[model samples]
Target chain A: MCGIAGRILNAPGRVGNDLVELMDAQEHRGADSTGFAVYGIPRDSGYILRGMGFNKARLDSDLEEFRLLLKEHGSDFLEDPTFVTSDAAHYCARMVISDPKDLAGWVKDADTISDSFEVQSCGRSLEIVKDTGGAVEVADKHGVRDMIGTHGLGHARLATESSVLPNASHPFWARPFSDVAIVHNGQITNYFTWRDRLHRLGYRFLTENDSELIAVWVSHEMSQGLTMEQALKLSIKQIDGVFTYMIARQDGIGFAKDRYAMKPLVVVWQDGEFAAATEEQAVRRIYPGESEVINYDGPSITEIWGVGNRRAAA
Target chain B: MSEIVIDVGQRPIREINEEIQTACKTAKPIVVRNTLSRHNLGIGLPPGVDITFEGSVGYYCAGLNTGATVTVEKNAGWAVAEGMSDGFVTVGGYAGMSCGAAMIGGLIHVKGNSGPRCGVAMKGGNIVVEGKIGYQSGFMSHAGKIIALGGAGESCADALWQGEVWVAGEIDSLGVDVNVVEPTAEEVAEVDAILDPLGLVDTSRNWRKMISGQRLWYFESRDANAWLMI
Candidate 1:
């Protein structure tokens, strides 16, 4: 079980501030990792920000190495890149890129050269951070308490089948494709079968968690021109067992329940926006009130609006 | 005495429900002043003329109601008329599990989805779910009629005893000892009779009559482990 929060903001210059606060409040959902992706208009990308602990000396050195590596790749790092630290290992970087095509290569290279700390794109131009601790500490350390974005997704993880390192934290980015990530609350029983198929198809995988496989599988399906709804519907037949997954992309977010609806997914739609969670409390923590909540049973589809609709709701 | 009003606005459940019971001594309608009340609200009554919960109740509300006519303006909880000896439990929303469990007599009607085990072991009365039911509904049911308008989950009518299960949607899995049999002439007449009251005879033909496999309930000995035999 993990905590997932985010919004499809109607008004926005940037939505980082709201996204950070939402993710930060749900830290206990996952003590091992905290990750988020912000889908913004005009700029779309992804990042895997890892925690480097309170060792300012080590982090400073790591930062230097990271910067040098960026320079070696012929990409200039952004000035005043954000880096916040907490008692629990936490660090973030704000990078600006002119070329979206180079994202997959850059993320793969970063993962390869970063030693054991893995890196991958969560959709295009999205950013993810997974550290060894809770969400609040990480938010305070990273100054995410005030950061907001237009359309963003966050995950607080409880590691079930992956390493406890930052590399294993969600939202696990689907490789090669930026702007696609997922924070799932149930097991994907067919992960191995799908993983093997993806592997043979030359799609790369960076983690061992079943959650990661879901991102890749969904991304692959989307790449094949299946609408997000179609992909989700097909997946229900392909994957078995109880699950409630919130898959986020640069364009939108989608939630699906298993055929049996064994697990829970609650949503509250108010004032033209919707918030969802595995439990009612998670959504209430962010938008407090006696809002009408929908308790979905069995194979309900909810697609969160993307940044394209930003001006409409505003 | 004036009628008591228990406001169950996210208040502790036991407090509100128990208070209603005590105030029910006046035989007046104890209004639970909330539009949304979750599970097990009005249950296990001794006797009362009339009581109404203002809002929708969660699962198992008004369970085992005896000698009362409970009307809910919204949805009701599971087992709405569970073991009800005599009463009328009406829901504007959905009624859930064991809507009339082992009930002697009563009426329960839901406007939405009901979970599994509906009308389980119901002795008498009619339970209606305008929506669907989950798996293992009416397991070992002794008697009663359960009507479902939506698709059923797996293992429907499992080990059913005497009773009728009417479904309007496709069945996922039929329970053991339970086989689809042609509706008897009496059964068809009964359906027509029931539908006539509700003013719904359009799907009369689509409604399939289901009953327990007599082998399980009529066995003279438990020596064969009758459950598996059924």
Candidate 2:
């Protein structure tokens, strides 16, 4: 079983740190990998891109080729790309870049170098940090606790359907869709079927993780003019599996459960903030006192919690 | 005669349970405080002991109970009294999914609503919910009684086996191979006996007792038409 969590603050505060606490409380669910999707303050100009390079030795050449491809898309690095390196061969990089002429086209070109260096998330406010370890280990490696964001999502994966590669960990950024990400708790049985269909439609999948497919699938539905609420409701019928997933956007976070209600989503909303997790104990870390919690325990349920000035308790 | 207070704040579950087990030897009343909705509290409790959780409890709070009297001041997470042979468990508020799963003997009273599959796969026990029961309340039961005073959610008593699901209010929908029959006076009296201790007996209510239709017991796999009936 995997663990997933989401947090929304009244303002841009320590959402990333709150997410870490949520995941850490549920580390026993899955220690195979830990990941976080932090949504910081939205920027109007440059975009922040986070990614991983397979070999730190090839960092220079891989980035050189990556820079030329960005130039072809009429975008250049606004600042130098910084790397987080260690004894392991793989390293993570964070870069701020000017706007590309065509984001989808540039993403297609970027996937060409995905074998060596892969971009995980690119958005004006979203930054996804993930690695192969428990919550505390990955948090210390990536500095997730200090991140500032209005809302975010977290995941602790057990690697059931695919190999336990670090890149296969979630929350997966919905590629070609900026500032959108998802963290899922169940296996999507028909993901391969939908994956072939989406692949024919020119959507690229970075990993075999089913959560990545759902990320892109929901975003694709929304791109086709479905509102976030409609898309979440449609996923319950369209997707075949026993899953409970939370999809987070720049505005807020939404969730959908499969027909059978195989997974649990316990939520506590108080004082204009929201906290949700696969288990109630995880959310208890946020509200230590006796508080009312809503269990989305029925079948085929979906909800959207908006992050704003007014109270969003539900 | 005094209450033995146990704090369960961020402490380890094993440690807390150990203290509880030791206190049970004293035969004093035990009260758990600052639960914080943690899981696996008060598991495998002994006989004749009295315990109460001051707040909402996480999964398997009074699981595997053996004749101990347990009460939660508020809601309980999944499988509150699973695998218990004998006990009296009371959830002051809601109870999560699979409330009394796999229990052979016990009486679980939920004051508020119950989540999906309230008595799923339960062998023997009596589960009484004062409020409505969620989807598929009595799924695949071997032998037991699930009584709901309020309405029932969709797909109630789906695929039940020998066990009886009695509802007094509106049922959203019946499940596959379920036969809802009018209970005889004796059957209604049996159910009333189960509810009498909880002070929930109502003589003016209409009862719908659900039992298995036995269609799935003898299945012909070669006949694809039989499979389409679901």
Candidate 3:
């Protein structure tokens, strides 16, 4: 079992803190590793990059190659990349870089060096902070509680279909799709089948985790001219699995449940604010006071909750 | 008889449950307060005990209950009366998925709607939902009865085995290998007997009683006959 959460504030406020509390209440669901995808205030020129390097010892060399690749793509780092190193072999980096001339081409080239250095997210607003620990531990290590954003997503992974590596954790960013990320609660049964199809179509996968497949699959559909609502509804028929996943862009959050309705999603969307989690107890942490919960417990269900005034590419 | 109040604000569930067990022995009505939708609040209470939770409760609130009269003032999380042999579980508001899962004997009255699989795999007892039962409610029950007054969600009463699902209003869809049959007057009276105590018996209503088509049981029966004689 896994715990997935999403929070959309009425305005750009302490969404990271609320998301941390949401994940903390559901740590028991899966404490294998916790991750947060916080959408900070959107930038106009530079994209915020969250990446992980497999070997902390070779961080300098790995980043040097990364910088060269970025320069080759007509984008250069605005500042030196900041690193968060730990006792583990892997290290996390945060960088601000000018937008690449071709975003998809740069991301495809970036994945060539993904064996050693992998970019987890690149968005004008979204910054994914994840590590191998509980919610409190990860939040403290990455200063997640202080992040400000209009919306965000959180995940507590159990490592059902993949290894328990930090980079394998969620929320998985839809690669080459800026500001789009997903956190899923159920396994995708037909993961390998669709992964092969998407891979054949030039989409790259970072982890063997089935949830990563969903991020790319949904984004792939949307890229093919389907709106977020249309893609979410289509996933119920095309994706063969028992899943309830919440995907977020800069503007809002959208969710879809599989046909079996195996996974549960509880929500409190009131007063222009929205909070959803795999369980009601987790959402209670966000709305401590009395608030009616809407249980998305039906099969083949999809919903889209628009965030503040931000406009997403959709 | 005086009433006893128990607070369950962020305290360890084990300690709170132990206190509840102690309070049950007093045979006085017990009220649980500040229940922040926490899981595993009350489990396996003995006979003659009466308890009421103030607000929403998390998963398995009155699970494994044995003859206690339990009430949740608001919503209840998954498997509210799961694995119960006997009890009275009343959710004043909505009850989450698998509301009476694997229950043997009891009555679970959900005033509000129920989540998916309302009486899944129940061997005996009855579940009365005033509002609509959610998707695939009464799934694969070995026995027992599930009555829904306010319609039912998709795939209602799917793949049953001797169990019965009675609906008063619209059924979105029927499940595979299900046989919808007209209820005899005697069966309706028996169902009314179960509902009379809760003041929910209404005549002049159209009833659709669903049962197993007996197709799913045939293969299982053939497999059972070939069991090793160990």
DockQ of each: 0.13, 0.89, 0.78
Give model 1 RMSD, 1 decimal: 6.5
Better of 2 and 3 by TM-score: 2
Docking band of candidate 1: incorrect
lDDT of candidate 3 over B92-111, digit per residue (tens):
99999999999999999999
Better of 1 and 2 by DockQ: 2
**Native A-B interface contacts kept, per candidate:** 0.00, 0.86, 0.79
**What is the lDDT, from 0 to 100, of the residue B113 in candidate 1?**
73
Model 3 error, position A114 (Å): 0.3
Candidate 3 root-mean-square deviation in Å: 3.6
Model 2 Cα lDDT, one tens digit per residue, A72-150: 9999999999889888889999999999999978988999889999999999999999999999999999999999888
Error of 3 at B132 (Å): 0.5
Model 2 interface root-mean-square deviation: 0.6
Deviation of model 1 at B122, angstroms: 8.9
What local distance difference test score does each model get?
0.65, 0.91, 0.91
* Candidate 2 positional error at A245, Å: 0.4
Give model 2's docking category. Answer: high
lDDT of 1 by residue, A52-125 (tens): 33344466676666666556566554444555544444344445533434655665566554443334443333
Worst 10 residues of 1 chain A by lDDT: A45-54
lDDT of 2 at B201: 91
